[model samples]
Target: MTDFSGLQQLTSLIRNIEAQMEGAKLMILTHEHREEIARHMVEGLVGPSREHKVRIETSSGEYMNQLAILEIGGNKYTFSKDHQGMFISEINYYTCRITPNSHGILVYHQDYPGVIHDVSRVLAENKINISSMNVSREQKGKSALLVSLTDEEIPQSLLSRLQQLPQVQQVLSLQ
Candidate 1:
C-alpha cells in the first residue's frame, strides 16, 4: 500500500505539536480535488458535523506542476509529486523535502556547530543507528530541520533527552 497523503502527514504533525484544530480553519489551493481533499481532511480531524469550520478554496489558475498548497491556522505547507515521489516540500516558511513514509526523527533546531554531533552522540549512546540524514536550513545560524532515517526505532526517553539538548527546539519521532 502507498503511504498516507501529505494532508495526513500535516494532520499528524499538527496533532504531534498539539495544535488546536477544533475551531481552526484550513484553506487548500490546488489544481484538482480541492473540495474532496479538504472535506476528507477536515472531517477526519473534527468529524463531519464540524467540517464547516474549515474553509476550502481553490486557486483560479493551476499550479505550474503537480502541487497543492495547504494553509491552516497561520502556517502554510506545500505538497508536490515528482519522479522522486511525493514530498512535503515546504513547512511554514522553512523549505524541506520530506517524504511521508520517512522513518526516524525530525529535529527542528538552531543551525549551529555541534548540534548534529550532539544528536548523533545521543543516538549512538542509545544504540540507535542512522541509515541516512538530510539537513535543511533557511540561512546560516538560523532555524534548521534535520531528517534522520534510523536503522531502528528511537525510544521515547531518548526523544525527550534529545529535546532537552541545547539549541534543540523540537524533536519528533516518526515510523
Candidate 2:
C-alpha cells in the first residue's frame, strides 16, 4: 500500500502556514485509489484549519497520481514526491519559496516593463536590500508572482505604496 503519512503531514503544515496569513480556504485534488483513507486523514489533519472541509477529487493525468494539490486563498499549490521518495514539489508557476530569516514579500501582478524598477525603487528608497528574488509567470507580458526576500522587514507604509502601483494586484508580507 502507498503511504500517505507524509502527504498528511505536509497538508497540515501548509494549512498552518496559510492560516497565519489571514486564514486559508482549502481544496485537495488527488488520485482515487484510497479515497476514504485520504479524506479521513486530511479531514483530521485540517480540522483546526480556517477551512475544514477538504474537497478531494481524482486527477486524470498519469503523472498526477502522487500529487496533492491544495487551493488556498484562490491560489493552487501542488505538492508531490520526487523520485527519491520524498515529497518535495509544489506547483512551480504559483509557488515560490522565500527563505527563512529573511523578510519576504509576495507580489501578484501583471508582467510589464518598469514594474520591477518601480518596486525596487520603493525598497531602495526605504533602505531595504533585496537578498533574493524568485519570479514565475505563465507567459511573457502576463500575470506573474514575485517573491522577494529582503534584508530587513518591510514596513506598512512601503507595502501600501507597492499595492498602489498600477501593475500590482496584491502584496503580502511574510516572515
Which is the leading candidate under TM-score?
Answer: 1
lDDT score of residue 81 within candidate 1: 64
Tens-place lDDT digits, model 1, residues 1-175: 3233555554555444436554455555554666666655565455557425655656664565435565665667676666666666776666666665455788999999999999999999888888887788889999898877787778889999999999999997764
TM-score of predicted structure 2: 0.58
lDDT of 2 by residue, 5-124 (tens): 555555554544455423333333444445644553465346535455455555554665345555665555665554444242443456554322347587888999888888888899
Candidate 1 accuracy as TM-score: 0.74
Q: Which prediction has the highest lDDT against the true structure?
A: 1
Instruction: Give the lDDT of residue 125 in candidate 1.
Output: 86
lDDT of each: 0.69, 0.63
Question: Which pairs clash inside model 2?
Answer: none
Alpha carbon lDDT at 113, candidate 2: 84
**C-alpha lDDT (0 to 100) for residue 146 of candidate 1:** 85
Query: What RMSD, rounded to one decimal, does every model reach?
Result: 3.5, 5.9
